[model samples]
Target: DHTHLKKALVFTNSRTDAEETILEMRRMAAKRGERDVFHVHHGSISAMLREETEAALRQGPGPAVAAATLTLELGIDLGELERVLQLGAPYSCASFVQRLGRSGRRGDAASEMIFVTPEEEDEEAQLPARMPWTLLRAIAVIELYVREKWVEPLNVRQLPVGLLYHQTMSILKSMGEAEPEDLKEAVLSLPSFRGIDPADYDAFMEYMIGMGHIETMEEGTVLIGLAGEKIVNNFRFYAVFKDDEEHVVYNGTEEIGSITTVPPPGYCFTLAGKLWKIEEVDTRHKAVYVKSSRGKVDTLWLGAGGDVHTRIMAKIREVLGSTALYPYLAPSAAARLERARRLAKESGLLTSEVLPAGGDSMFILPWAGSRQFRTLERLLKNNLKGRLGLRSIVPMEPYYMVVAGRTDAETLQEEIIA
Candidate 1:
């Protein structure tokens, strides 16, 4: 708690983590007699609240902590922050570096980041649980940046059909009406839509027209239809990314933030680093009214995992294979890594791709990225299942897959080779 008074930005991977983490932080702050010190910021929150949180962090006379996701990771100037805290392993080295750059922006001060990797307490540990995956990943990311100056390359999406459609609707909505050729030129002139085929766009426009999203006048001009107008007129239409329907949470008349779902009356929920008891649910306006309450409540938010590069996975494998200890690791973390390395050595996982997992089960270490691992899984289940006598195939994703089959390790490996 030495840095409790230091202004910091606590980064989480998702909105749910941001909410929960802020709640926990607020609880701890309350014990220290701190009030209105913790704030929450994420995409789901209202723009006004997010701006307020940004302002709080940027020009605070006293220490104020903001628990946030990537929404606060880059772009905004939060002044000179004393520290950056990451809740879990960041998905990429680029992300790690971007977050690390948030601190120590003034003068010659060195940037500081404190990674908090939470370990699960399981009485009966599973094979995956035995290894410190999060710790290893955090180490690998740091090493990759420090040692090799390597960051995962950005993989830009090629065919952004959704963005294209969004732009089309926006253009039509703004221009009111235009000839098909003029509309085509206007939409396709944008750099993002440069790769899109004109013929394909025509086909898409025809489909949209048929679906009532656009209308064609007798004069051969195109305009936004009632359906498209409904979409274009909404505030959310500006965003091209997929957004889930969320209910706005309000403290009396003041808007707190938005969540994916609203609880019924008498239910308690968390938002913007504070707990509230649901007094009423406004279904028509998609809002929730609440009053300040104590204790704890968990709220659900939708999240998805990001893709891990094969290079990072290879670095993880190297970390497991080597005996070199990372200086940044604490004693407990070093001990945990030692145990994991010992297990890896004993199970021959470092050198071998296949390892025995108790009776009638074996592990296949693909050491590939998510997409590659999924492809290998399909190959095992669809193509190699019968040949290898595989009964059940379960994947832990982007890592090793466990399969329970009749065939032995040697036979399974040999069969896989064939």
Candidate 2:
């Protein structure tokens, strides 16, 4: 209730959730007879509205609460925000830090973050109900950051065919014409393309020529071909990553928003606050014509998925296996942990490292993380299918696997170990 004076920046995974959060906050404020003051800022919002929200956030000590997606996680400054709250599971360790750093920018006051974890269900699903994966994941991220200060290394570029294709076109467009060897040296020498070999470059250029993205002149120099010229001349060619040409979405004369792709007729989508159905699409102009229609539609949200580190998954296993209680957990979180532990013990999970389900089914606990577990799964499914007289071998990630066959859990464990 006292959050009015907090001057907070709240973050969620998707734009729809951000907008919905602000909407809910507005409703709460209205009930209390306070001004409905929460605002939303994301990529698709109107430029004017985004600018106004940013200006208000940067102005000063007044109540400026903005709920946003990762649009605010970058270098953009938004004055001295009092609180930074994370509403859902953060996608990565790097993102977690970026959102956390937004607060505590004001002098020695020390910035603050509040994570609101939802309550877990009691049903005996695949994963234990008590060990909330969301909360444990949050803890695991914090642990990784503190212990190793580790972030995922950039993906290796063994064959950057996409970038190579893009850059070759760019170099030709910029220099207009160059020798094949000279072009290879020029394009492949760049840091991003340095991994590419000259032979690969030659092959790529030859393919491009064959495909009409490049043309071989009589002088042995290469120039952009007719097809390549069409691409380079278009504004979309300069982009590193591929996307649809900017399609402006309009409801009648007024622009609701714009997206990379235009929906076909009768396809409904959510934009701003309400749903709209596509009326017409102009491919030549790259415009999506729409008209208002409101029932329910799937929210449009673009998010970057993260790969869980082996170390964090190991930490999650430790949390479940150990009796140590994390101090950061609230009472509810503590109870959740306790129930999970109890379930594990009652099922003979921690003691025998295996438990029974019903019929011929058994759960085998393997503390190894995803990479190892995946390898184990492949090993069982491929190698041990006939050797151990095994009927089935299943590998569940982050915890245990369900293995059922004629063999008992103990005998199977011995056989697998042997």
Candidate 3:
């Protein structure tokens, strides 16, 4: 009831989803004869609109719900909240815990959270070698938090080149032209740029000059050149990563939402749990205007979302070793696990304790976290090859490898140690 829901925050994974959800909530509120008290907040939403929504939420009472992305996950104190709802699996455990902490502020008994994973039936789906085990992973994350309070450590080892480029332009724009040494010190001293090396900074300047992104005057002052000006002048240049070519979805004159990488005219796709047909494309302004329709097509980005945790991988191994049977193990999940077990046994990975899939140019399934896995990949690329005739290698996650040539396991092991 509206009386019970003093204030609620619903977290969605994407900007489009956030927009769609707020619309649905408002419609439901209208149906119940209640006030339209829902706010949408996401990156794509205009700053003025977001500010208005935030102000409304702060003014309390009357069951105001805010549908938001990661923008609201951080330390934006919303006073007391009745509950927080997560739409699906959060990208990480830290994010999940952060969202959960938003509720129960006003000394209420306990905060409440409802994690909902909207299901879809795919008839022609070929499942994994072991079911995703998302439930187990979620449980494990909670258990680990209770026992050891583990939060995944952030990796800042590699300097973010894209961020560096952004900061360079920002410094130039803010402080006007600056001397090369002074510019280097200004950037290197910043806390966020601590991972960046002074030498790399020098190389960056050279790259900028080569790419016509920056220029040095006769007076030896570094300034944002023509190319840099073109980039910085654009609103999209404020963001570090590349933005997808998206079109604005509108119902008449009202902007409903946005879609990424527009499809050809007359093509339809599902977005925000609704179908849309591209009506017009404004290539000059990089916007697509669309209208709503019915019928479903692949809409979600099939990009590599994120990496699985080492603990989760370890737990998957433990699941295989144990005799317990999970009731939710769908037929596909069961078959996949069996297949993995059979492969594991055939390769003598279980008993021998050897990294079973070994050859002169084999892939190593360390079950290590992404950072460690990447480190091993780099180490192998640097050390092996010329010494052992090992050529190309590609690592497929969980446990699979593609090797270049045929060589004995013992020799590979020796080379790995050396």
The lDDT values for all models are 0.84, 0.74, 0.65
- Top lDDT: which candidate number? 1
lDDT of 1 by residue, 1-418 (tens): 6348878899888887888988887777878787767789987777888998899889967588889888887899999887789988887899999999998788998887988898863637656557777888898899999899999886877778888889999888888999999989999999998888999999999999998999999998989988888988888889767678788888877888887777789888777877889998888998888999987687766667667788888999999989997888879888888888888887678787888888999888878888788888888999999887899999888778889988898888777767
* Candidate 3 lDDT tens digits, 1-418: 4223567788877765675676566556767887767787776555556776677667756467788888898767676777677776565667777887877677755655666544343434322223333444544455455456877777565777778789888888787889999888888888888878788889889999888889889999988889888989998887767877666655466665566666777877654434567788777776666688755455534444356668755655565455555544455545545655555555554443224243344445565555566666666567765665667767555333444555555666666566
- Order of all candidates by lDDT, from best down to worst? 1, 2, 3
Per-model TM against the reference: 0.79, 0.70, 0.62
After superposition, which runs of candidate 3 have C-alpha atoms over 4 Å from their true positions? 1-88, 102-108, 111-128, 131-133, 154-180, 193-241, 307-363, 375-405, 408-418
lDDT of 3: 0.65
TM-score of 2: 0.70
| Total clashing pairs in model 2 | 1
RMSD of each: 4.9, 6.0, 7.0
